[model samples]
Target chain A: MFNRAILIGLAVLLACVVAPAQFRRGGGNAPKEGADAPDFNLKVLKTKKKKIKLSSYEGKKPVALIFGSYT
Target chain B: MQFLLVYIREAHPSDERRGRGRGRGRGPEVKQPKTFEERTEVASECVENLKLSMPAVIDNMKNTAGTAYAGFPDRLFLVDKKGKIAYAGARGPRGFSPEKLEDSIKAVLKNKGVAPRKSTKNKKSQGRGN
Candidate 1:
């Protein structure tokens, strides 16, 4: 029974360590400062029919991309 | 300078973070939207309730923009005219400071030799002479 307990404890510890690493990996890589911003084409929420691409504003203006949700 | 609010996945949903409560009295108690249409609907409600003046866009269901920018929860970024990331705000609820963002915008405009516009209506007219 003692051996089984040690095995279970080791398994839990391994899982704890691996879980966070997996979570961090799940977040993917973010663009670094001074690097070219990744281009995206997204639908305008106000006008659901219309779509906007980040590349369209590449040379025209300085863009502020505020990323968030209602919650 | 152009501003775009990219709506991402919910930070606190009724199902995931119920214990925290929305804080505001009877605040929106919505679940994480499952469909693109549902997500857009939630975003519309946010825009209307907040009376947000800037144009808002909805990230794809896969959250491409969110993953690329690490924008989950909330964050702000300033992209220069050359399409490079001029400023990437720290991950939010804590780092979501509009003043800091505005300061960065002003600095960028100054660097380009453009004076910041006084009127809210003139915000859309920037970067023209460049």
Candidate 2:
């Protein structure tokens, strides 16, 4: 009985760490390589511009999207 | 290196705001932005204050850019001129590595036949994102 309990506890602990590691806060459902990158309209803080669509970059130049908070 | 910084919701609320029941957390807290305008403001502040030179884009409510790019807290991606993802850096705070990102950019640019832009000044400072 003790052995079984230990095994079960071990399994539970393993699940906790593995789950969070696999599903990280950043990069949820990341796109696969060679997939058509999805596009969206995000405001440009630098120019205080609007209606800047990601699709516009398509067929023009590769666009890299960086995400993060300052502090 | 060509990069963009997406300013999303804050992880914490300012100290004063929290004291007044305005937000959460303490010690220079920045509450998560509820609107795109608010996000833009935060992004602008970072750029101006930090002297961030890289180009950046703001994520929408859906955070489509963030989700698609797998960016949060901080992350880097290198895309080919054709808009296909080339290299994906590790997660931020700990896994984030500027050197790896720079290498990815150089590799992608070279593969695309774009001559690497030469910088007479210190290139390290420009690529390092805090």
Q: Which candidate is the best by DockQ?
A: 2
Residue B2's lDDT in candidate 2:
45
lDDT of 1 by residue, B19-39 (tens): 266543356777889999999
Interface RMSD for model 1 amounts to 5.3
Give the TM-score, chain B only, in order for the candidates. Answer: 0.78, 0.67
Best by lDDT: 1
Candidate 1: lDDT of B113? Answer: 20
TM-score of 1: 0.74
Candidate 1, B54: how far from true, in Å? 0.8
lDDT string, candidate 2, B2-118, tens digits: 456666655444533433453233324455667777777777777787788876677778877776666665676656666666555667756577787677666666666232443
Q: Candidate 2: give the TM-score of chain A.
A: 0.57
Please tell me which predicted candidate would have the highest TM-score against the true structure: 1
